[model samples]
Target: EPEVTQTPSHQVTQMGQEVILRCVPISNHLYFYWYRQILGQKVEFLVSFYNNEISEKSEIFDDQFSVERPDGSNFTLKIRSTKLEDSAMYFCASSVGRSSYEQYFGPGTRLTVT
Candidate 1:
């Protein structure tokens, strides 16, 4: 089975800097999502996208955060300005449908802000 893949397994950046986390989900999946897990905290949803537009977004996804399907296969999360609180393991997930059971997650990109 095909799986989601992420680049730069770990990333370190200065506070207030911009960061773009990339992922390539299973080719056939239609829905994509961005989630983050803070140290010792449960996973939290950031946003969900479908048909090249945002379907839903959490309060945590503020003006600073944006999601885009830049091309046919790439989905990306851009943090316009990072903060210490943004440091977490960011996961990219996709599903054939909107059901939770169909979702598949990537290894994750660990973002550490200084």
Candidate 2:
């Protein structure tokens, strides 16, 4: 079975620098989403994308953040300017459909901002 994969399992960046996290979900899946978990905090939904546009987003997804699918298989999240609060483990997930489907989560990319 195909599963989601992410690159650079861990990322370290300086505060105020731009960072891009990459993910490749199962080839056959249609819906994609992003979630983040700060150390010692609960997992929070960041955004969901479908058909090349954002379907839903949380307040955490502000002007400083963006998501894109540069290619058919790769979905990426970019932070225009990193803050200490942005440091967390970002997870990429996908499912066959958005409603009542089980989401498969990637191993996650840990972002450490100083």
| Residue 27 error, candidate 2, Å | 0.5
For candidate 1, what's the RMSD?
0.8
Error of 1 at 54 (Å): 0.5
Residue 30 displacement in candidate 1 (angstroms):
0.6
Clashes of 2: 0
lDDT of 1 by residue, 1-114 (tens): 799999879999999999999999999999999999999999999999999999999999999999999999999999999999999999999999985557899999999999
Error of 2 at 98 (Å): 1.4
lDDT of 2 by residue, 1-114 (tens): 789999779999999999999999999899999999999999999999999999999999999999999999999999999999999999999999978999999999999999
- Candidate 1 lDDT at 25 equals 96
Those runs of model 1 whose alpha carbons end farther than 4 Å from true positions after fitting are none
Q: Alpha-carbon error at 31 in model 1, in Å?
A: 0.3
Model 2 residue 47 CA deviation in Å: 0.2
Please give the distance, in angstroms, between residue 85's alpha carbon in candidate 2 and its true position after superposition.
0.7
RMSD of each: 0.8, 0.5
Residue 52 displacement (Å), model 2: 0.3
Each prediction's number of clashing residue pairs: 0, 0
Each candidate structure's TM-score, on Cα atoms with residue i matched to residue i, is 0.97, 0.98
